[model samples]
Target chain A: MAINLKIENKAVVEKIAKLEEHLHLQALKGFFAEVADMTMFTLRFFKEALKPRYEFKELIKQAYLIGYKSFPLIAITGLIMGLVLTIQSRPTLAEFGAESWLPAMVAVSIVREIGPVITALIFAGKVGSGIGAELASMKVTEQIDAMEVSGINPFKYLVVTRIAAATFMLPVLVIASDAISMYGAYIGVNLKGDVTFHLFFLEVFDKLSFSDVFPALIKTVFFGFAVGLIGCFKGYNADKGTEGVGKSANAAVVYGSLMVFVIDMIAVQVTSLFS
Target chain B: MKKTTGNKVKLGIFVSASVILLITGIYFIGQRQQLFNNTFTISGIFKDINGLEVGNNVRFAGINVGVVEDIQQVTDSTVKVDMVIRDETRKFMKKNAKAIIGSDGLMGNQIVTIIPGPAGKAQVVDNDIIATAKTVSMDEILTKIKVTADNAAIITTDLAAVIDNIHAGKGTIGKLLMDSSMAGTVNDAMVNIKQAAGGLNQNMTAASHNFLLRGYFKKKEKKAQDKADEEKKASEKDKK
Candidate 1:
């Protein structure tokens, strides 16, 4: 009875070990698969972004959809962000009697870091989910497949244009958002103190330079690219039947946001290295 | 087709606006650097730069008229700084104008301040080496403050000793301030001076009445009376 029990115990342990190994391998495989899909999507963008057929009209529609249509939401969020940052930063700076540095401090934060990252996250939430769900539904209904059958390059038509739109539009949005945020910060500064609009802007820009503006603006392009590509990638490879749509949309946002921070970290390090 | 054209127009506008904003920003920054304007170069040699660096503004009478373009250490004590000034400001900057490395505010960045020379002096020519003043570095100021504080400490120590001596009635002033015997002596001296003064006043009155000095006094009095009578006669003649 002892020997039989030992054999059964050994067999159970082996089975459990094997199951653990399989789970680990599956996770590894999924990670690599996602990486491969992202790489492929990036390659497709490079291919279509340069080609002469230029979906110029579609690009415009996407820009309008991405930039103009999203203005009010971005404006509101930007104002709140500026106001809150100013109100919170006041006491800390006031302790040093450096309340005068408020505009410059707020400007740097908005231009260099906060404006891009927050705006991108907001974009991922709104646009990423929209693209993911819209494409997933189209994919489920076999519309993309139908387009392929009709000799349309669905990847170029759908993915590239949207990505291009995002890539171009995001920088514009960030600029507009930064301007609005500074204005908001001005209102915030004037809440307890006095600063003329011109002097406020002067102090803000006095501390700003190409190093702060260019690298920040440059990173937003990658941010837009990541947000648009991840959304499109998830939707492109979404499962059929019924349940995959919600999962794809959720993953798009989560991953898109994750990638923005990752890219931002790398960009900052590289900028610092050069600077 | 019409819809597509409209969309294209919209995109065109968006892209153009962003590009325009960016270009305008670039232009302003460039203008600040004096990239698009006519400019001239001038140099100054200083004993110390006071932490002034390239790209610091050069101010003339508190106006930003140029920027520090270069800085080179010539020796352990001297630094050579170059400035690129607007051509428009060149006429106002004389060869004798002095340059000093200063700060924007108490805690602000360092800038080269150009103190305009006398009005009659000629303008500084291109690449002219202008005079420089030794800029007071933060360390220098702190060192000076330390010296001053040390001197003040010594002075206070000496003063405290002096005050203690005065309180203890050890010196003349101390005796005057704190000694009861010294006060009594001063009172005696005051009484003696008052008596001597009264005696001198009586002696003067007796001398004035004596014959030897009295004729001189009488002659002086007669001259005064004659002058007074002459003045009265002149006044009466004018009235008549």
Candidate 2:
């Protein structure tokens, strides 16, 4: 009896190990499969984007929904970011007797990095999830299929328009956010100290250059494209009905936000190479 | 339809405002760089730039007048810097004006400061090479500070030794201040000196009263009296 029990225990352990190996292999396969699908999706996007019958009306609508609607949140966050950064940075700079450098330092920080990145994250949370859930629900309800059956190109009408609007509108939003953040920084500087508006702006412009502005603006275009593409890809391919919609939205936000940082890292590396 | 139109109008306005803001920002930065202005180029040769890069401000009379446009290594030891200054500033900048690389603050970017030349010199023309003075770099200042700090450390060490010696009553000042026995001896000497001085005074009185010294004392008294009388006569004449 003792010998039989030992053999059974060994067999069970072997089975468990095999199961674990199988699960890891499945995960690896799924990751590569997803990467392949995403590549195809991106290629399709470029192809459709460059093709003739452009969806101007839909693009305009998406821009309004994505860019204009996202402004209030972006603006509020921008103001807080600027104010908090200045307030927090003041103590350290003051220790070095460099409080006068507040405006120029804050301006470079916001224009070069914080303004585009934070705005893009907020945009991903709002628009990425919204696009993901909307298309996911449409997919589950067979609306995409119905449109296709009725001789309409749903992918061109839905996906390309959104991606294009996102690519173009993000830079504009970032510019507005940067301006508002500068005002916030000015207010912050005057909270504990006094600097005239003229001098404040002069210091800000003194430190800024074409290199700081142009590369930051260009990267937002990529950040927007990533967010929109990820959201659309997740939603358009969703399955399993109502459950799929929730999963798609959650994954969209997660992946979109992730892609923003990844793209940012690449952009910084590329910019540094040129600089 | 109405809602769509309204949304479009709002979007248009927002886009326009954002674009305007961007343009305004660009304009300000450009203006600081002497871009979109009537400008002229000038160059200065310096022994070392001390990390002054292109696009650093060129300040004239404490106001930003231009930007550093280019920097080239002219020799192993000298660098030539090109500046784009506004044309309007030409009258103020003279041929003998000197450019010095300075910092914006204790911790700020390097700037080229143009010190105006003496009046009556010719105005600087475009592409003119101006003289440059070697401004002190932070490393040099820090090196000087380190030397001072080292001297201070040595002085402090010596001072501490001197204080220790005084505490141990090793030197004259130390003995004067810290030795109780010496202090008692000094007190006794002071008393003896006082007694000696009193005896000298009495002896001098006695000596003045002696016959031979009496004549001398009497003569001194008479001379002092005559001097006083002459002074009184002089005052009377002046008053009259």
Candidate 3:
């Protein structure tokens, strides 16, 4: 009976020890593995990007589909973003009797931070899922293998073009969206007060410096790259089933958004170092 | 194939429009900073900039005509600020133009205001070191405000005490304002004054008509009549 008790006690201790190890070490282990995988994937992207087979024509097509197609939605979103932000910010600035500063304040808020972030998030939701599901469906149907057997460079045509399109197109979209949003802000400012278009733009230009603009612009490029890369990574590695398609689409948006915020944080820190 | 070309053209227009929009924005912002404009550089040495930064607007005659391009510490007590003013505004800036750091509003960013010098002075040239006036910093203004506020507080407190004294009927003014006894005293004094004036008038009238003074009064009347007669003759002669 004593021997049985000893064995039971020893087993209980071992179980607790195993539980502790899982709790303490497993999370760190998983995180490091994820980081390693991400780094390797990024390296693969760089390698694939420099590959010999060009996909210029496909890139233009994808650009049309991704950028041109996304404009109306992004434009509407941008307008709403500027209008809502201005309308919402009025009371706070009014409290300080700084209602005249509306143009500068709204312009800085939109151009520096909100325009790129909200647009990138929207882009991730729309384009990320679209790429993920399309690629995932192709993978599940073994169409990728069929293309490979048929002697076409599928990655160059498929992955590279889409990624490049997203990478280049986002900045264009952001620029357009920012301009439209400023126009929307002008309307917002005029809703309760009178400000001519000329004065409003002058006020905006007065406050915004190159430092305010260029860093924000450069970060959007990185945001575009991150969103596209994460989407491609998730979709291209999807399992060969219909369920994998759904998972890929969902993970694509989730990871893309997560990485956008992650990249924004890092970008802000680095930008602070310069200015 | 035709549809593809059409789509490509549409895409091209969109891309070009977007790039144009970006360039236009950059141009305007750059123009505000005197980056694209033909500009003339000028430097001012200030003891304190009062938080004036690079890219802060430099106003001339209440118009933003330049921007602060650089700020560097020249000495322990002096900071040199380089400015780039639009070439168009250069003609208005006199060689003796004074740069004073001022704020946009009561609570806005610091700006350097260029006060035009004497009208006869020559126009300022490029790279000229302009004169700088010692500006009152926000902290200094706040300190002055605090002192004024303190004085106000003391005055208000003293006023309150004076008001309380009036309410309690303490000082002469307090008594005048608040004391019913003082009011009655003033009323009695006024009545006494009125009686004294009446008595004095009576005495003067009695004295004027006294028997001893009757002769003197008659003599005075005769002299006055003679003078009136003489004045009348002179007036008649002048009229003639």
- Please name the candidate that would achieve the greatest lDDT relative to the true structure: 2
Worst 10 residues of 1 chain A by lDDT: A201-210
* lDDT tens per residue, model 3, B9-59: 988999999999988888988888887889999999999888889888899
Query: What tens digits encode model 3's per-residue C-alpha lDDT throughout A65-134?
Result: 9899999999999999989999999999999999999999999999999999999999999999999999
Model 1 Cα displacement at A188 (Å)?
1.7
Clashing pairs in 1: none
Off by over 4 Å in 3: A1-31, B145-240
| Each model's lDDT | 0.87, 0.94, 0.90
The local distance difference test score of model 3 is 0.90
DockQ of candidate 2 (2 decimals):
0.71
The 10-residue segment of model 1 chain B with minimum total lDDT is B24-33
Residue-by-residue lDDT tens digits, candidate 1, A22-137: 99999999999978878887887798778877876677788888887787798899998898899889999999888999998998999899999999999988888888888888
Ranking by DockQ: 2, 3, 1
Enumerate residue pairs that collide in model 3: none
Give me the displacement of residue A268 in model 1, in angstroms. 1.2
Each predicted complex: what DockQ? Answer: 0.24, 0.71, 0.63
**Which ranges in model 2 have alpha carbons more than 4 Å from their true place?**
A1-4, A94-97, A190-196, B1-6, B152-240
